[model samples]
Target: MPAQPSPAQSAQTQLERGNGPEPSTLDAHRCQEVACGNVLRDLYEGLVTEDAQGRLVPGMAQRWTVSADGRTWRFVLRPGLRWSNGEALDAGQIVASFRRAFAPATAAPFGELFDALDQAQAVQAGRVAPERLGVSAPDPRTVEFRLNRSASLPALLTLPIAFPVYLPAVRRHGAQHTRPGQLVSNGAYTLAAWTPQANLQLRRNPRFHDAAAVAIERVRFHVTEDAAAELQRFAAGDLHITEVVPPQPLVSLRRRFGAQLRLSPYLGAFWLGLNTTRAPFRDAPCAAGATRCDDRALALRRALAMAVDRDKLTRYVTGLGETPAYGTVPPGIAGYTPAQAAWSDLPQAQREAHARALYRYAGYSARNPLTLELRYNTSTPHRRLALAVAAMWRQTLGVQVRLRNEEWKVFVQNRKQRAITQAFRGGWIGDLADARNFLAAFGNDGPLNWTGYDDAGYRERLARADAAATDAARNAWLRAAEQRLLNDHAAIPLYFYTSKHLVSERVRGFQPNALDRHASRWLSLSP
Candidate 1:
């Protein structure tokens, strides 16, 4: 932790941060983007939160304990907790918030995350009412959760979807509860103003429990979808921190900004998601075989996965200090080792030859190459990466590729529906510092499983992993699940992401973490 600057020592009490496009909503349970999570963390405090280094720390809950069986958890809230509106916030409201998030009518995007809770799956499926959820308020200051199976309650609670919402505001204003004037939060900040696709202003919440320790009085998040434009803003001293740096000008930016440029390993994976629910990528039953299978769709997917040169892509197109990912999960997670594809150790030339053979086996050749469309969101880096990938496939496998780009919102919707998406750019940033967060996304019912990979074997492996009682047992199951995913060629892993940003020297307490989470409450603007 860094020393906080006193009001007299700092000339400005507000910090400006560059971010991506506007969040679709400010509701913690509904919003899905990382940028939205960043803002929501400041406005709403979960029972468990992270410190500057992304380690789990106490937030609204002062302390918590789990039962010996690990199926039940209890949390004791801090004294005198209140919403930004100055109304007393009690444990009952917390329970109500959890129920609202899991209600079938709410359709929370990440509702699957709470499947561990007792009756949660049934509640989300409309089989049971939301009131049947496992969470309960034992007393005004105590909230309890009963899980049907063992899970890390602390890690689950740290996610934004687990954060409590103000039910009164929602009841009074409906969907408009998230608007600036109506939004009532309990974190270190309150929504002051918002202009979509432009910027949002957050002022310090005096009603926050730990407001006395907060240093920055205001945080202004400017929408910076264009990395080049964001870089210019940073160079012009208009932003104290940038969301991301353009990869193409890395050499010059590093030379110009020096220590101001921040790059650190991130717990994320950039991958290409092949729509397994559609043609060319869908899998079929394979004949009984010891070491070979005659599945055309499987062959096509493997060929596409092997054709790409991830090392070259990272070196030339990304330019950022990223590792070529052979597996879905990135490195550095504790107690787990990621499994790579079988061809990961093969030479590039040999890999290309194998890919070409597979392509031919899948009924494609120089005379009749497979034609496919690759979709990605409109951005400079995304365009460059798509072009590089297209060129790689064309050169290595003689595949005809078409590139299409859409805005952020439309792109997300299309990807989720998977109706028009053949192959699309997809990535995952870990919500928790756990391997489960990455591998679970490939599960048949995974909330973020946009690839439409529905494998009973894969789902079984994940279930075993989640039910394992010991760490070693759990890790083995996770390893097996990852291997299964890789063998199926469900998605092509390109590179592990590295967090890139430009931080002005005046900003203090902006510690870099693998999770890339930095709250404004801990940051101070120094003179």
Candidate 2:
């Protein structure tokens, strides 16, 4: 077991404040990838947290009081927490930083994610003054949000990136200077250095209220794309954490360092998206029909779901600690419940009948077969899963899928283009724990709704849920919307997610959450 840190340990006093270069901007709005996100996290803090179970919890705001109507929340900021540059952390900064994020020039991918904030949409549209943005820090120690509606307030606050407190110092520097050392942050750790494509170094932030509790004096994030290379590097003691490792290597790790090989799913679900606006998919009856394309897709989806052999996949693809997914929501989130319908093996005769009927409906002659293209990233485990799925589709649906492979970057771009591939694989980590996060992707105007399925009735239901007055009522509408999605076969649910990490024996007091925030506030290391 890793040696842990105590909450009251005297924080390292040798560190100097603002030892790095001065920043041109203190904002985190323009960062693009995971590496940039890790860099910016050090400088910002949010009001809520997505815990290990993918549940929302209080963050910088110790707690909040909500009105019965759910339109307002009074957040009490933690006292005496300061940014690394010595500015007293206050509510005014939160208001200013968020206002800047809404600016069109900032082009923040998360600009819409914060629409729940008071007057946020209005402010973004230039209809309101930035100061009237609904977030008021009446005093240096307090902040309050006047919301537009009632729904997942805390989860909305736990976005994966940005939402950090910004200082006036950053607005002057602007987006151009918002690099690693150019800014001061208010999180559990501070940026030590970032060597491109190598490692990102972070050390404890003395100004953080809970800094005394941080266990690791220095943390290093090594960027390696290959799973086999990552595990080999881990065994050689070259890295602290390696993610998305392949199954065969994971088995060897468990056999050798059983306790160190941690296993958990991230809060995400992989699925096959059908471009409902194009091709045979565009024809609603054809899409929903028992004909070849529709029928083959449904049978293939079901057969693939049932034949996945989740236990084997979990043991190999995920290294255990993962549950087979029957729905979009992962197992541990508050509203997630497994669907009553289970996918089990069908009799060979029935399977053949279904496949034949589907092919016939798809307009295929008796001798012809329905074929489509499938695309996935080239990760070793993903390769295995894709091959398994392809094989299952062939045997059960009698449909042959041509597998297309690409690097992670290219594959993502292809999906965005709605390219030639018929079915593409992907998942999203819940930015917050709302069912809306899942259902919204299917909504007509959902920003991330890559599937391009537009259902007017479903869209209305989503709007109603968003406008509901109570969490209970809102969640009920959201669940009904989910049922509609399931009944419609909008997308196939692959598996719920868990994050996996392997901590060294010397690293202590580490806590992993589905939101992927490293809560080192209470961590400390033994000498």
Candidate 3:
């Protein structure tokens, strides 16, 4: 094992080397908060990329070919690859890693991506033998994957970051990778030293497939979760890159570092979710009923949606860097050309009236009102938004709303357990640039489907998209699925996310991905 440097020592080393100071990596929270794709881009190489228009382009594997039947995909592994551990890279490891991902009890979060593989679900469910798994490596250099359906299989692997293919030594030790000795990265960089909750140090991997092209020699990540503290540190010129800045700090930084202030629209959406399996939401007729109670509830939701005012929320919470969303799909997503203006153009009165009519058609009256509970993350912004929406519901529909705010982790737990109050918060990052990423969140059986909305018609359309062979045809189904959600009011779009950052002018070659992961491989710090 390499001798690990203490956080202070490592950070000071970077400073002394005139590379500025690297961002904190305290919680391994890189993927959650910052543009982690940049970090991953530095660490791993992949097969394809999403162009500016969100189309897939070739990456590590160059170009691939699919069998005439679309059942088999062949990827010719790049020659002369090596793991950071000094082991020769081969196709066997790739196939082995993917097989493990599909193995029963593994339950890799990305299991769904392999659903197109023949009998993958059955194998994962233990209904079929693992031997029936649909991937094969003909030799140490050739990889082929068999799919149950024909579609853009390569696009699925086109995610910006590598999927962390496991080496035999690392996998043999089991699921823990806490120390430098245990970590064997195949990406552009390898863990040289790590101190949990303090600092993580990465060094250039000479054995990496593209080592010649990697520019950064060493990278350090410090864990700085406190937003205010982070901004203060950055302002003192102690840090090179930072995550989010509160409005106050943003104002100051904008004045001091005008050109350094960077903002990019995020390919994610924040929204509210109603659990449809329970109570008033369970019965289609009751949910659709035109009774005064249902009518009031419907009016209340629409009014709250209008009154919450995303622009105000962003200004207060996100420094007005984010674009307020009117639909589930992000603006630049394929098949989502904004035919009209923003949803803000839809008059509040008309929206409220439409809500009332929807309730009336299902069975409701304006004379009676419905009372419901709303849940939010304990963050001040979410709580404030909840309160504002509640007030609007009361004024517009004469309905009573109770607000419940829980810590962020607790809120996530309740949502997963379906113990949420009447309504709670939800959002999704774009896995792919297609509307399918957004639509996949609504299916009852999906991982992100917090709303418990299960419509046979919607599922039918989703399946069609999954089964689609051509890019154009699949995109059509994707568009239909999103339109279905909008017409049914399945989920309300709060806003499209935009990442705001203050980068030092000295940091060069740092390009941000819409998916919110920062890659350090493509970056270099100047003196």
lDDT of 3 by residue, 1-527 (tens): 99887875554335211111132221121122223344444555555555434446555565678898888998887777777778777777766656665667564434555577888778777788766778778997777888888756776775432244554644566545525677666677776775544556678888876678766677766555455566677778877777655455466766877877777777888787766667545533454555643343333334445545566556665554677666777877755553212345766676566555544454434665566788876554455557766775666555577888765556656776665556787777777666776776575464457777777788888899888767777777777777666645546677777766667777776576666555565566665
* Maximum-lDDT candidate: 1
Q: Best TM-score goes to which candidate?
A: 1
In each prediction, how many residue pairs overlap at the backbone (N, C-alpha, C within less than 3 A)? 0, 23, 35
lDDT of 2 by residue, 1-527 (tens): 97765634423311111111112123466543343454454545677654434456667888888898787888788877688777787777776776676665554555556666777766666677777777777777677778787655666666533366455556656553444676567776776776654555677787877666555565555556556666677778665556555456555668887777666546677666655555544443455545554354444333334434444555555655666555666655675442422332454456456555555555654266557677886666667777776776676556567988876556656665664656767666666655667666677443356566677778778778878767677777877777666655556666666666666554455466666555434434443
The sequence of per-residue lDDT tens digits that candidate 1 reaches over residues 143-225 is: 99999888888987877789888988899999999999999999999999999889999999999999999999889999888
Q: State the local distance difference test value for candidate 2.
A: 0.60
Q: In model 3, which range of ten residues has the least summed lDDT?
A: 15-24
> Considering summed lDDT, which 10 consecutive residues are worst modelled in model 2?
13-22
Can you tell me which runs of candidate 2 are displaced by over 4 Å? 1-43, 49-59, 79-81, 110-115, 119-132, 165-175, 249-253, 264-266, 284-319, 335-356, 364-371, 398-410, 417-422, 468-472, 512-516
